[model samples]
Target: MTGVLTDGPASTRSPARFVAFGGAAAVLLTVVMVGSLDLHRLTTTAVGLRRTISEYALGPYRWVFDTAVVLLAAGSLAILAVLVRKGITRWASGGSLAFIAWSVGLTLVVVFPKHDWSVGPSMSGSIHRVASLVAFISLPIAALLLARPWLRDAVWGAHARRTFRFGLLSALSFTPILYAVLVNVLVGTSWWRVLPLGYIERLLVLVEVVSVLVVAVWAIAAAQPSYRRSNTSR
Candidate 1:
């Protein structure tokens, strides 16, 4: 995988851009797709935000959602590839692995849409929910681990630490939202919906996107242009 990180013989500016762009794309694609959907019918009338975005996988234009998730998965792996090429540190390796696992979970969610609660849980929906929950949990852990090595990189020192701090804050914001999601899932109760469900979930999604993006964009910005010239350094 590291071998293929190169684009032909040239380094190509910086491949780290892929991760940054991919993170931005993930959020954008979801928003655009959901905006295109008929929310009046998709979301509950009383609780407009009661529905999770995953529920849209069953919509008429589900192809949009599916394609977006698949792209995100590929993008995540691309991120790992860049990190490996940059010189994998112990922390980076673990971070890369965690992100890869998160990508796989998203892939499964694409394969199996969320369950139709109206009809109760089927095997596929059950798998989807569990996958989504696990994936959500792993991303923040990855962010924290990935930040460790970057803090020590002289070339990327201050910027890396700043980005890491932002990532951690964003990840922390996701905790309660995730808990609300779990409550809806486990208790099968409408209590979670009592709050601004749509707002809460959207906040979580935004934080997740922001967390990933800060690291990715920082990676892009921090990439050493003379990497090839300084082959003896690391």
Candidate 2:
């Protein structure tokens, strides 16, 4: 994998740019995912993000959602590969693992629906929950881990700082809402029906999307000899 992704020893910035652009495209498609759903029927405030995605996966147009996730996962893997090739140091390895874990979680979302968990504690549902947790946790961790190295690298310092801020904000954004959701879950309370989890989760998703784009920009900047030269020269 390393050899294939890092095969080019040329000083050109093509690879990083490609991965960066792909990441941007993936984020855009993810935004479109909301429009693809029947928002009126599925009221955002009540439904969980996982439940919505899972239900969509079972719907007649499941392929649309599934394909988007697959593309996003592919883009993530490509970004990780480039990160490894650059050998940015400081949690890069951990970040790579986090990337893979996130992709796995994405795949599991389609494979295991919400029923296995929401209907009752079934094996499939358990796996779905596990996948969702891993996906949610790993993405932020990867951003954090990668951020330090980017911050330390002189050429990428400013971009790294920005990426770190975006990542930290994204990670922290959902804490209060997540607390509310967990409290509801633990108490088996009916308040969750009105808690607006879907809306909160969507907001978190937006943060995450921004975080990804910010990181992609950092990666592109880091891969170059220097930002100005990469653009001005070959």
Candidate 3:
């Protein structure tokens, strides 16, 4: 908010505002890259929704996919830095650790491409699968934990409520994946074959990314002079 930038003392506000803006910009960059790729897919290629997002990496747009993922990881780290600096989250806290794990997992996902069934399973693919799992599972947990403390605060309560709900929604979106697993375990079929895995994954990602954005906005709010004074007084 402009108030955040203008109300605080210039010396303190300058650095905090810069970090906050940088974090937000990084997050926005991921959105831009992903959006452009998806737009191309939608209009030019008509890439089937049933195909997983990672499928992009197997095609000409591999660089775009990889860059988006790396940017997202970088954004997560920036968000964590802002939260830690503002004391909204501690470096050793569960929320902070979850965020760190999410960032690391995202980085690993970019480093290792998804398993190509035609090529058979490989170690890099296995690591990619595990990393994707960790990244998906970690972010909502981090958002929930981080939202908890601000749930009752007047200034941040609304934003916290939004983050908490989005986190829950993001968690719930994984139910189909769980169902796929259950079907695989019970019927001895491949897990990925049970559902529209691609669509479900995309939905899950959208909700999780939204949760992250909400928390980033909250961090920006926390950087405000009014919020800082209130927090200090408490």
Candidate 4:
């Protein structure tokens, strides 16, 4: 039941531990900010559930939205750094690339405001749409791929499974949207209006963020080279 699991050298682990802590804090802050904004919208503006989160970019609180998204990207980058340091994922690996895409997409979403379908599609709006899709889609894939290796580890197996499940949940949250799209196509109705798009999207974002937090916790817990849990006595 006892084994030496190599986390990393002390020097490397120190910096990685710092990065992981900061990353987790930033991500948590993002949740707070977004949640507050949504709460405010519900009480004051009474925005409909079908309205997208990106629509916040068009409001007076645009700066807050931008800052939250930037923080999310920055935090994701920090987690990625820790993952690389711990050898959980490589810089050239598919998981790393997908994570990078997710981070980059978040940044682009902040830079480019949401598309106003009423005003018709424009270049910036198109970019924003694509970026949103990339960010939403990539994070789940990254989580699944990154957590795949440690899924069988004696110590980290439970943590890995939790991360994988969050990823899967986030990915599966899109099914309703897909079904709505297919229905829209067949009936010539608006897909966005067919369901509570905002609520569904919020669920997806929450699950994906939880996945990142789970991975960050794993990285932080496993930062020490001597870190281990034993079930058997020596």
Candidate 4 lDDT, 1-234, residue by residue in tens: 322465555454576788889998999999999998898888876565557888889889899989998999999989888767765667888888999999999999998898777787879888998899899889989888877877887767887798888889878986787788898999978888788889988888888888889888977865654554343401
User: What are the C-alpha RMSDs, in order, of all predicted structures?
Assistant: 5.6, 6.4, 3.4, 4.6
**Candidate 1 lDDT over residue span 1-234, tens digit each:** 111122345455555555545655664565566555536544645656556777668776588778877766665566555555565333246777777777888899999888887888799998997787667766776777676765776555665586567667757766676676678788876645646655666676657656666666655553534433134322
Rate residue 122 of model 2 by lDDT: 70
Clash pairs for candidate 2: none
lDDT of 2 by residue, 1-234 (tens): 011123345567576667766766776786676455745335754543534445566556678777777766776666666555455432337766776787788778767765533356677777876787777777787777666655754456676688778778878975855777677778876533646655666667678767777766656654664333322110
Per-model TM against the reference:
0.74, 0.75, 0.89, 0.88
Candidate 1: stretches off by over 4 Å? 1-47, 88-92, 177-196, 222-224, 228-234
Arrange candidates, best TM-score first: 3, 4, 2, 1
Query: Relative to the unseen true structure, what is the C-alpha lDDT of residue 18 in candidate 4, on a scale of 0 to 100?
Result: 84
lDDT of 2 at 232: 17
Q: Is candidate 1 or candidate 2 better by TM-score?
A: 2
Error of 1 at 23 (Å): 7.1
Indicate the worst ten consecutive residues by lDDT in candidate 4.
225-234
**Clashing residue pairs in candidate 3, if any?**
none
Model 4 bad stretches (over 4 Å): 1-13, 225-234
Alpha-carbon local distance difference test for all models:
0.64, 0.64, 0.80, 0.82
Rate residue 182 of model 2 by lDDT: 75
**Error at 56, model 3, angstroms:** 1.7
**Highest-scoring model, lDDT:** 4
